[model samples]
Target: MYDYDQVTAFLGKWGPFQRLIFFLLSASIIPNGFNGLSAVFLAGTPEHRCRVPASANLSSEWLNNSIPLEERDGRQVLSRCRRYRLEALAHFSATNLEPGRDVNLSQVEQEKCLDGWEYSREPYLSTIVSEWDLVCDNDWKSPLTTSLFFVGVLFGSFISGQLSDKFGRKNVLFLTMGIQTGFGFLQIFSTSWEMFSILFLIVGMGQISNYVAAFVLGTEILGKSIRIVYCTLGVCIFYAFGYMLLPLCAYFIREWRMLLLALTVPGLLYIPLWWFIPESPRWLLAQGRVQEAEDIIRKAAEKNHVTAPDVIFDPIKVQDLNSQEQQTYSILDLVRTRNIRSITIMCVILWMVISIGYFGLSLDTPNLHGNVYINCFLSAVIEVPAYTISWLLLQYLPRRYSMAAVLFLGGCVLLFIQLVPTYLSVVSITLMMIGKFGITSSFSMVYVYTAELYPTVVRNMGVGASSMASRFGSILSPYFVYLGAYDRFLPYILMGSLTVLTGILTLFLPESYGAPLPDTIEQMLRVKGIKYRSASKSQRRLKYGEENSVILKNTSL
Candidate 1:
């Protein structure tokens, strides 16, 4: 409804109905955090070496020497793929009775694990890497698994909007939840990497679909004042809760399958939400299901102990009061003017860089040189403060400089991690966490700042294009994390370099602290602080039919 306030004014805000939608929708977002990052533990590669069977009858010295050591991080460690030729170890030369002490290991011929491999069980009982033997030359497969999921996410974003309008938001929301849960559980039974990857892709699709659906639904149902809270603290914070729970679950259940199973079963609890969470009354009204919309609104009014007007919305008035010819805008519109073009380019780069940094830091948890569980938990827990601080900054600070400062802070600390001694892993992890905090805050702030930068004609299109750029960033994120296999600091260095570059670019953007939203490119480029200087608050209020678009900026990760 263009005039939804007319209805919500009687329905009242913060009442039982709004409360239910707020908490239930927020709770529904919890699984996404775990689902998104579960790959960190599920695909974790444990320390492994060639498995020398007892049937070889090699002596203790020979058995110990069977697996060769390689230099990594300035220290020798057991080779994951290469080993001393077992044939030579089984039949030692008469001149050299003991290996390593007498014979130089460098002279020994090395070969791939001929007998298979044995993995260390100190941290993980099993992971997909161990199960599928996705190590050695195939180590890239581990990160590829995470990237494929985001590929599914990219496809999901393409279709979710059309599907949401085709089917009701509530319908698609629960349907996606079911898909996430069902596929998540089914993933444990995957016999090969191919099967798990396929299921994971579909689950990724559902994960994002529901998140978008829930976000849109909340915007439609919640009153104007509460929608912002629902967008920021409600959905985002609960996602952190689920993220926090993931490490705790993985800690107790070291086996990847068990951890995966434990993380997915909670979806069943949200199944009952179908009854408690109603369809968006506004969607029903738009669909011309006015009776249905009225029914939901009436229920809400009664639930809130408020009186509803005898006739909430007249059908004739709805059709005649605010009807206008719809205007269409495409990606081309974003670059139609000089200001819009510059803004679009900058916003896309910023959004993509933020996605890469955030997901890169998250997937790097296992490689943080400490207890993976604790590191993962710390990574998840920090988001709460990151979000709170972001909310505070957006309220008081100028949008342009605050975003640049956080990105600079995050990037600089990540680069500093390279300066610290590798042995001082605590310092490295601490710096990495600070980087996550900055990226996370930037991630939240970018949506608000970028949306304001665009004219209304292409506002949604501007954000959509930027968000699509972000999906590509996320798809490439695991590979950035994969760089850690070569050097522990490599991923951070790459992300930091890009992040710092993006931060520098942020300085070019015009400040939008209190500027009224521009409806056209000329308006957007107009001199600051003209008529809008004083009327900014009233002029910036969300207009009818526009509040629903806020969901377009929902942070899916």
Candidate 2:
């Protein structure tokens, strides 16, 4: 019986139908990119000091003296959270009016800011921090806000996968797009941090759920030759494109609310695309709706301008699928088998480490030396070449080596950042970007490698499990960058050390480059001792014994 790829081959690759699907699906990803990192600009904290109240009755001459100066980084700056007692300062001024006298300034008592704080507005006109007065005692709220968004993401990832399988992919995709856009709009009008956090959680759920819907739809429908490009260049590059657009948006629209409103406008454009894209035919076939699946395939053929045979989907293949015993697998199954269990544990660790390092560096872009706008933009810009380099490596290098080498290189660069002289911050920034490039490549490669490593029965679950581990990493990422408050190099040291160790762990996984996708866990175990190479048509037919199932090339997840 002919398979889905065979049906796709008959329709022709790169046709009008395929182009529409790719364009619309890819366009949907751009808004997710903007919302995912909007926290960088929205929660920015600027230089600030205690606000001296009018009741202090201080003249311009006494204004500077109202707030006590403390040593910070070997230089004196006004204390951010404290001010001198007004009565003591007034008495000191009245008693010792002479300049340069031994007034014993240390005797002045300090107190917490009674009035609100004054913020420097040059970098940001306003942010969540400045607007809500989330400073000093409330400073912990900023990172917690970012982490809470990812906590929303964590829950979203868990339920979205199962929901997509039950509901149609197209329906869920559209639903998530609406959820993301609607909640994003609500974030602009939030009156309190609590209100914004709840809205942000809903938006987070929509963010990952939307991505999963698009990813699965693209992987299942596109032709085999074009599937890799769709997953890598089609989906990922557009995400980077949206990322590159983020700093530009934030640069011009300096106000946090307006910037969020601006970022969310693009998602509204995607609502119309619902009419242009089709539901996944593979999903229809899996549900035993062969006639509906065939109808869509025929529609694709018509749009591709190819003539399709009257008999499109083979009945025998559908019957075989229906007749096959339904087997159930769970997360425990991943750890139940000995060999699969080992691979699963390693993958989970690898994903978690990669995510923490990737996101830690991404969120820390604002802290890097230079203009925050330029630094954030450069952080996004570096991914362009990194993706290009990754594309080249996927063609020539083994998956295990390429993944490990990039991780190790990125880790080494991060470790070296600690040694750069503090004055040479530009040098340090450059090294961090280099490390980001390496981690970016590893991040891109891991999705494909993990998909290839797992069998068909548990492929979605395996990828989902690893992705869930990644959410935990993302939840912790803000805190990792938060470590900079204690010491500038702490974030880098932790990220680098974890990356280096995980890089070594990656070497033990079997190489998937040029390998056939295993259909079962037993087949995957046998692959360890096997040498995989590209095969001719005759060899593929002989290998799979062409009674029905086809030996197709592996596609990226």
- On lDDT, the candidate that comes out on top is 1
Mind giving the per-residue lDDT tens digits that candidate 1 earns over 1-557? 35777656977778988998899999999999999999989999898988888887788767777777778878988888988777777668434477767777789888887777899997999999999899887888898999999998998898888899989999999999999999999998999999999999999999999999999999889988898788878888999999999999998999999899999999999988999999988777777787898888889888999898898878876665446566877778888765677777788899999999999999889887889999999999989999998988988999878999999999999999999997888999899999999999999888888888888888878888998999999999999998877887889899999999999989888888988998877788532223333335555575533665655556442
lDDT accuracy of residue 32 in candidate 1: 97
Enumerate residue pairs that collide in model 2.
none
lDDT string for model 2 (1-557, tens) is 44678765888888999898988888888887888888999999888988987776665556667778887644688888888877776666566553225455567688887788999996899999999988888889899999888998998898887888999899999999899999999999999988988898889999999988998899888888788888887888888888889999999998999999998888878877877788898888888888888889888888988898988877778779767885888878788766688888899999999999988998999888789999888888888788877877887899999999999999999999989986898999999999999999999889999999998889878998899899999999999998887778889999999999999988888888898988788777432433545679898887768533343322321
**lDDT of all predictions:** 0.88, 0.86
Q: Give TM per candidate.
A: 0.92, 0.91
Model 1 poorest 10 in a row by lDDT: 526-535
Judged by TM-score, which candidate is best?
1
Give the Å error, residue 75, model 1: 1.1
Note the residue pairs that clash in candidate 1. Answer: none
Native-to-model Cα distance after best TM-score fit, residue 448 in candidate 1, in Å:
1.2
Off by over 4 Å in 1: 93-96, 321-323, 526-557
In TM-score terms, candidate 2 sits at 0.91
